[model samples]
Target: MSKFDKALTAIEETVNGALLLSATLLLFINVILRYVFTSSTTWAEEAIRYAIVWVTFFGASLCARNKMHVGIDIFIQMAPPLIKKCLLAFAQLTAAFFTAFITYFGWVSTELVIETAQKSPAMLMPMWIVYISMPLGSALMTIRFVAAAVAILRDKTTGAEVKNEDAVDISRL
Candidate 1:
């Protein structure tokens, strides 16, 4: 991985690490308060919900960066060398295109939310803040996928097929 990729990954890790830690702590405290005191912070649930939404979008980008998204790689793994290279190239390019398409629509939705000045009932936070994640996450994912595709093409041109160690194999767990 390049230094630039390392920097971006570190930033994503910091943001998501803080988000998950805070959300977990908030929920734990909220549960304790509701049960022990027979009362709840009115904004706790809303805060947790928003935190989860933020985490999910950001986490997805992290997953994209790591190439951890679920993939049925059985076929690719079994294919002949040249065919496998072609398949991998096709898949990476396809993912980039798909994410860019989603980002475009997500931006449209974000604009609508911003223009309408929608507010959440609990905290009256501008809904655009939450809506912005959709485009932001998809855009981040698009960039990652494009990078992956370019890397694959470059490697293929140079006759290299580097395995991604970061790709999660969930069956092991």
Candidate 2:
């Protein structure tokens, strides 16, 4: 990978890992406090919830970058090379469009929350900070999708087969 790609991957992986670890640790400590100490942090649950939401959104972008999202490619695999290429291109473009749509609407929602000055109940953090995840994640996914589409079309035009990262091995299964 190029330096920029490596850096982006590192950032995505680091953020996802840190958030997941923090959420798990916080939950474990909260459980211990609730049972043994008979006291718990009021903000723990809310923090965990928001952490999970961010993790999920960021994870989706990570998945898009790795092409790890679930897909049923039985038909595409069976199709002729030309048809398969067309199908793959179509799928990628469609996904790009969907993610772009989400990014646009998500930003709008985040802006509205910002204007309202909404705060999260427990942490009192600006609601826009949390709400912005949708746009940010979808924007990343949109870029990935567009890149995939370009790669697919380019490879197809050059008589190369498109390769998916998560291709299933039936014999192993």
Candidate 3:
């Protein structure tokens, strides 16, 4: 991968890993506190929930980067090489358009939340911070989709296929 792609992958992986790990640890601590001390932080659950939300969004981008999204590829698999390439490109472009739509509306929703000064009940944290994840994640996914579409088109021109090493072969299972 190029340096930019490597950097983006690193950032996404690190953020997702950290958020997941932190949420797990926080939940464990909350359980211990409630069981052993008969008490727990009121905001722990809310914090964990928000962390999970962030992780889900960031993880979606990683899924796109790795080409791990589920799809019915039987027809594409059976098609001629040129037709398959075109179909794949079309799929990527469609995903890009969908994500772009989400990003635009998400940003608008987040802005509205910010303007209303909405806050979480448990933690009193600004709701916009949580809502912002939608736009950010969708934006990142849009970038990934555009990149995938470009790579697909470029491969068609150069007679090369994009190879993703992280893809799982479920049939092997």
Q: Each prediction's TM-score against the native?
A: 0.87, 0.89, 0.89
Against the reference, the lDDT scores of all candidates come to 0.80, 0.85, 0.87
Off by over 4 Å in 3: 156-173
User: Which candidate should be chosen as best, given lDDT against the real structure?
Assistant: 3
User: Could you tell me the lDDT of residue 168 within candidate 3?
Assistant: 51
| lDDT at 78, model 3 | 57
Model 3, residue 137: what's the lDDT?
93
> lDDT for model 2, on a 0 to 1 scale?
0.85
Q: C-alpha displacement of 154 in model 1, angstroms? A: 0.9
TM-score of decoy 3: 0.89
Query: For model 3, what is the error of residue 89's alpha carbon versus the real structure, in angstroms, after optimal superposition?
Result: 0.8
